[model samples]
Target: MCLQSDLVDADVDPAVIEATRSALHQQLEDAELIHQPDEAHLQTAKERSEQLNFAISSLRRQLDAQTRDVVAPRFDAIADTSPRVASLKASIDAITQLRESWARVHTINADIRSLKSERRRINKDIKEKSEQLKARQSLLGDLSTEFGRLLTSWNLPWVDTAVIDRDTFLPAVNGQPFESLQASGGGITTSVNLACSLTLLKFGLDHADVLVPSLLVIDSPRKAFGNNDSDRQRASEIYSRFRTLADAYGERLQLIIADNDPPPVTSDSFGKVEFDYDNPMVPGVSHPGPDHVSRLEETADE
Candidate 1:
């Protein structure tokens, strides 16, 4: 009976020890779940603490740079200075309008240069045109001489000779001013006009550089405008002179004389193309005759 009781006591002691160990293990697990940090959380908190320390160190270094040991009292003098005269001790991030304004100034200067160049070009053109005009007008003296010779040949009355006035480019009779020819009626006037026309013709034929074509067309020189029966001899003389020119220049000069009842001048140098009421310029058209005008005048007088 004593041995059985001792074995039972040994078994009870082992059960109490096991209960105490289980209770201590359960307390330790509860404390760990409530307050102890995990491995990943501890690593993240360490990295955050290191970043904060580095930021503090950087701030302290920046503060040291602004301390009295580095910055001098001379910087305080800028406080009383004007904005225009003040200078900065430290570089600052900035943008200003001066660079853009300078660019605009350059653009305006380029435009001015271009305008000056164009003005020079225009001045050159004006000078060249003026020179060309002066050159073309250099033959005025020779033209005046030819005009006087033609007036003498055509028998201008009451004048020893006539000259072309430089200012008006018209005839000046016997050293008279413009329009000073003492002539009445159409007789002397017609002679003067014929002489002027022939003078121009001769001048143009002589001067190839002049702006005159090598062509002339004289239409109806006898019927109405100044060529009467009294001036028939003079008109015939002019036609003979034309015949002489047509023979001299040949094909180089083209002289077309269209007179229905032509003056008494005939030559192989002048080709004849006659047109009457039958064979007209157009097939079914004809001009009203000079007699038609005279008849109308008679009716008006009535």
Candidate 2:
């Protein structure tokens, strides 16, 4: 029967083949499970650790070689480029600083021009205002006509005074002769002198657009009269006429007239400060008065 089965082995049962295969695998598993390790098996963990160390050492060598051969030379090349980069940065910063300075200069120049323009505008405004003031001042002349007429009628001979230099022309008034003569002369008559002086003073006051610093000093105004009662009365009348004119422009003008002596002047318009050198407060000859003390003392001692 065994010989007949060998001849038909190719036509075997599935369960029988599977059982045979499973039995062989189970024997292999059992044999592998029961086998004792060699010395090489015990050194497996050490061997793996040594292999890892060697790989790490080889990697370190490769890194060293790369650093020395490639990376170090490249680093030196990069270091060589740093100075030029720094110089370029410094140049760019300088250019930026210069540009800022130029911009500041332009701004200051603009401010100066604007200030000049404003100054010109202010000057023009002041000029216009000054012209307006001058125009307003010109209008005051029209009002002086009535004032002059009224002052003349009030016996004010100040307005009737005449001022004649070498070039002045005189016209005859009330059939009186027109007298034109040099300033320094005994040849000039008293009436002509009085008329000329009175007219000149009046015209000057009337035409004055602005005040001039001047003194109206009439020294010995009473000299126009002679040393008699009738002549003195005429002089008083003429002086009264002059005083009326002085009164008219009292606040705006000043008149200082002197005579040989003082009288009780009646005008309430002007102030009078009296001083008589001839009359002394003290009676003694050595001390005549405060003014004559020096002369009188010398004479008294002699």
For residues 110-137, write the lDDT of model 1, one tens digit per residue: 9999999999999999899888767655
Worst lDDT 10-window in candidate 2: 162-171
Clashing pairs in 2: 159-202, 160-198, 160-199, 161-198, 161-199, 161-200, 162-198, 162-199, 162-200, 163-200
Model 1: residues with Cα > 4 Å off, grouped in runs:
1-108, 160-185, 206-215, 219-237, 256-268, 271-302
Model 2 Cα lDDT, one tens digit per residue, 230-261 = 55654666567567767776665566666676
Error of 1 at 4 (Å): 72
Error of 2 at 151 (Å): 16
**Could you tell me every candidate's TM-score relative to the true structure?**
0.48, 0.32
Native-vs-model 1 lDDT? 0.71
Tell me the TM-score of model 1: 0.48
Off by over 4 Å in 2: 1-191, 209-214, 263-265, 278-302
